[model samples]
Target: MRRAISVGRDQLMSVGVCFGKFTKSGKFKLHITALDYLAQYAKFKLWIKPNGEMQFLYGNHIAKAHVGRISEDVPEHQGIVIFSMADVPLGFGVTARSTVDIRKLQPTDIVVFHQADVGEYLREQDTLF
Candidate 1:
């Protein structure tokens, strides 16, 4: 099943794969994707700091804006995507952008933003038995 997330007036910078309570790390692996808002493509990986901040690993980059949170549900082994409001075209491929504090997130609470690129990908690809 496919789900849509409303980013609202604020733009998002990166998508996060929150492994809520399932892993000991207590952190999410934020990822950047190849598709632009207009559907153009590029490639690269970016890493996220421990404090939920974003940085680039191998190319010139733009700073991310801090947006308020929106809630959505993610199934097992699922993730969410974040989009940049400022129109900073991201490099292609999935990148680890940063981590988030998952302490207060309940199993039902939307721990990860459910509209990110990686989240959408996971929802589309079925598991091969």
Candidate 2:
């Protein structure tokens, strides 16, 4: 015979979820879960085309040609959430150009540098669980 064990919400809270952490240099590093929560409230966002969505899921940066739309005032080097044109949250990255600067960018120029992506959940499942 065996007994099943159950943990309470307080127990889970004690273990704590690793949302993010501040680095030695004081920069905050966000985990994928945190990115998902923050995506909805993010001021800057990039809605990318299907091709870009696939590339982004593969951990690649976004190029200008693949951008479907951009939020009005995204500044250069600002952290922004990436989304599919259909409005699914995909990942997050830092903008390579500001709204004004991007206007002068070439089609192939990098628009966003990949930080973290939803694919990481599957790719890092072993470590997560």
* Candidate 2 C-alpha lDDT tens digits along 57-95: 988999999999999988889999998999989989999
Query: Count of backbone clashes for each model?
Result: 12, 0
Please tell me which predicted candidate would have the highest TM-score against the true structure: 2
Q: Report lDDT (Cα) of residue 89, candidate 1.
A: 34
Report the C-alpha lDDT of model 1 over 18-102, residue by residue, as the tens digit.
2212236766433333334323322222222322223222222222222223223323233223333333432222211322423
Q: List per-prediction Cα lDDT, in the order shown.
A: 0.31, 0.85
TM-score for each candidate, following the candidate numbering: 0.22, 0.81
In candidate 2, position 98 carries an lDDT of 96
Q: Where does candidate 2 stray beyond 4 Å?
A: 1-17, 22-27
lDDT comparing candidate 1 with the true structure: 0.31
